[model samples]
Structures are given as structure tokens and as C-alpha cells.
Target: MSPSTSVLDMLSITPPGWGGVLITGAFATLFISFGAYLFGMTLGLFGALGKLSGIRPLQYALNLYTTIVRAVPELILIVSLYYAGTDGLNRILALADFGPIEVNGLVAAIAVLGFVQGAYMTEVLRGAILAIPVGQVEAAKAFGMRPGLRFRRIVLPALIPNALPGFANLWMSVIKDSALIAVVGYQELALAARVAASNTKQYMVFFLAAAALYLVITIVSNMLFSALEGYFRRGQRPVA
Candidate 1:
């Protein structure tokens, strides 16, 4: 058969094609990235707040958390956290006389990646919060604004403008990091491509397709983040 027909046959979604496998894997990747990104944001927000909360103990604890997570290699963190979390949960259950329960891979993957993402996000958000002018917060306080009110009315708005670029970077990082899930035997885009290549003995074709899919995701994400950044940066004078 010609190379064109061979490529088509290998990629075809019908009987022999692995296209469906790749598409499903891509969806899984997106789901994991989205879930982890949101979870990380929640953790980072609290982590950032804790770091700035003036409670020495809380600040120390958060510092330890972020420092360790950022220091470790991400692959090791993912594998270690994935097993430790599941095993620890089962151990807790076992103490209560319950059978070991299987954790959902999706949930486990999200939790692990989110945990790692939170550390970097903590610094990003903390820096952003720090960048806000103290005078604005002080003025709000002088106007009888409660701490909560000041945060909502003044701090958050200012924080986003500074935080957004970092957030965008994190989002892209998470998307790529989701591929690491495959190392723990979870079948995402990379793994799916591996399977297809192994079956067809056409490594280049399948791997290239996977790369193309990833590129597409990155392109779309960049567009979305650009739009969001534009929205947040509106009314500000352009930087020289």
C-alpha cells in the first residue's frame, strides 16, 4: 500500500484505526487539566491568604508546603503522591475495619496534579497580592470597610491584573503536565499514542499526531488566555 493509504488506515476511526482511542485520550487529558487547574486555584487562593494572614504558624506551615512541592521534580511528586494518597486513604479505611477501596483514577490524578500546581500558584498569587498598593487597602479601611469588604472591593480586582500572566503560565504548564499521568499507567494522549504505535509499528505517525493534538490544545489555550488577559487589563495604559 502507498504511504498515504497507510497513514489513512492507521489513523482511521473505523475498525482498524486508532483515531477513537486518541480522541478519547485527548478528552481525558483536557478533563484532568481543567479539574486540576481549578482545584489548584482554590488551594492557591487559601495558601496565598494564609501566607499573608499574619499568623506565624499558618505562614510557616504554608511555607513548608510550597517549598517542598516546588523543590521536588514533578514526575516524582505525581507518582509519589498518587500512590501515597491512595494507600493512605486505604490505610485509614482499614483501621475502621473497611475493605481497601479503589480510588478513581480521574480523581486521584486531579488531586496529585492540583497539589503540585498549588505550590507554584501560591507564589504567583502571593506575589500578586503583595503587588497591590498598600494605600488602597488602607484607604478602604479608613472608609470603614471590613477586611472582607476591602478584599472583595479593592484587593481582588488589583490582584487579578497582576496575577493573570502567572495564571496563564500555570494553565499551560498543567496542560502539559497532564501527560505525566501516563507514567503511572493512566492512558492519556501520550499513552494512547504509544499503544497505537506499538500495535501498528508506526511510531512516528502516531507520536506526531499526538504532538499535533497537543499543539492544537496549546494554540486554543493561548487564544483564550489572551482574551482573558485583555479583559482584565482593560482601561490600564499600555506598558511602554
Candidate 2:
């Protein structure tokens, strides 16, 4: 194929065996990030609350969790989790007399990435929670609001507006981190590009296409985040 035709053909997301692979990889990247972000956020919400809980042990434990995850390199975490984590999980299942579970690559990718992302999310949420006016919470308490009610009615809403910027950053990081899991055999965009380039010897074309796809995701994410930030910012006092 001519250079122009080769580039054009490889970029096609339509039929022919190779064309759709990278496109599918791009979607897999998005899927992993979505799962990781949600999982991370769940861990983060609890971690943040634990840090602020005034229980020394809880604070210590969360501090350790975030500290360890943050201190390690992401590549190491991915490697360690893929090999050791799966084995450990299966071991536990075996002890429980349950069938051995094969860890799916996509699921492992999300879990590994989410495990790392959660530490960062913890700090982000803890700061957002701290930024909430203490008086507001106290007032709710004085009104006989239960802790759950106070958080649900007063804290969470206020936190959303403040938390969104941090969440946006975390989300972007998650998308990029999705590439890391490709090392662990998750056929995300990076892996997809590598395979295509390897097969076609069109290194520049496939790699650049992967770059463009990543940029597209980042751009789309920024636009979405801008809309969300605006939607939440409307009723708030201006950030100084």
C-alpha cells in the first residue's frame, strides 16, 4: 500500500482485521478509567472521612494507605498487583472452598489503577471536606441533625462544588494511568498501538494515531469538566 493509503487504511475504525483494534483499545482505555475513577472515589470518600474521624487508629490507617500508595511508583504497583494480587485473591477463595477465580485483565486494570488513584482521591476529598465551614456542620449538629443527615444535606452538596476541580484532575490522571495497565497485558491504547506498529511496521502512523486518540479524550474531558464546574459554581461565592 502507498504511504498515504496505508495511513488512511490503518486509521479506519471499520472492518478489516487491524483497523478496529486500536479503536477498541481506545474504548478499553476509557472503560478502565471510568471503573477506576468510580472505585477510587468510593475509597476516597471513606478515606477522607476516616482521616477526619478523630479516631487515631483510623487516621493512622488511612494515612498509611495513602502514604504507601503515593510513595510507590505506579509501574511497580501495576506489576505487583497483576501477579501477586491475583494469586492472593485466588488463595483466599480457595481457603473459603470457593472456585478459583481467574482475574480478568480489564477488571484487574481497574482495580490496580483504582487502588493507586484512591490515595490521591483521599487527599483531594479530605481537603475539600476540611474546606467546608465548620460552622455549617456545627449548626446542623445543633439543630439535632444526625451525622449522616448532616453530611447528606449540608456537607455533600457543598463539597461537590469544591471537590469538582480535584475530581477533574483525578479523572485526567486516570485516563493517562490507563496506559500503565497496558504493561500488565490489558490491551489499552498503548498496547494497541504497539501491536499495530509491530505488525504493519507503520510505527509513526500508529503511534501518532494513538497520541491523537489520547489528545481527543483529554480535550473531550476538559470540555465536560468545564461544564460540570460551571454547573456547580453558579450559586457559590467566588473563590478568592
Model 2 misplacement above 4 A: none
**Candidate 2, 165: how far from true, in Å?**
1.2
> What lDDT does each candidate get?
0.94, 0.90
Q: List the candidates' TM-scores in order.
A: 0.97, 0.95
Backbone clashes for every candidate come to 0, 0
lDDT of 1 by residue, 27-76 (tens): 99999999999999999999999999999999999999999999999999
Candidates in order: C-alpha RMSD to true structure: 1.0, 1.4
Weakest 10 consecutive residues, lDDT, candidate 2?
A: 10-19
Model 1 misplaced stretches (Cα beyond 4 Å): none
Best lDDT among the predictions, by candidate number? 1
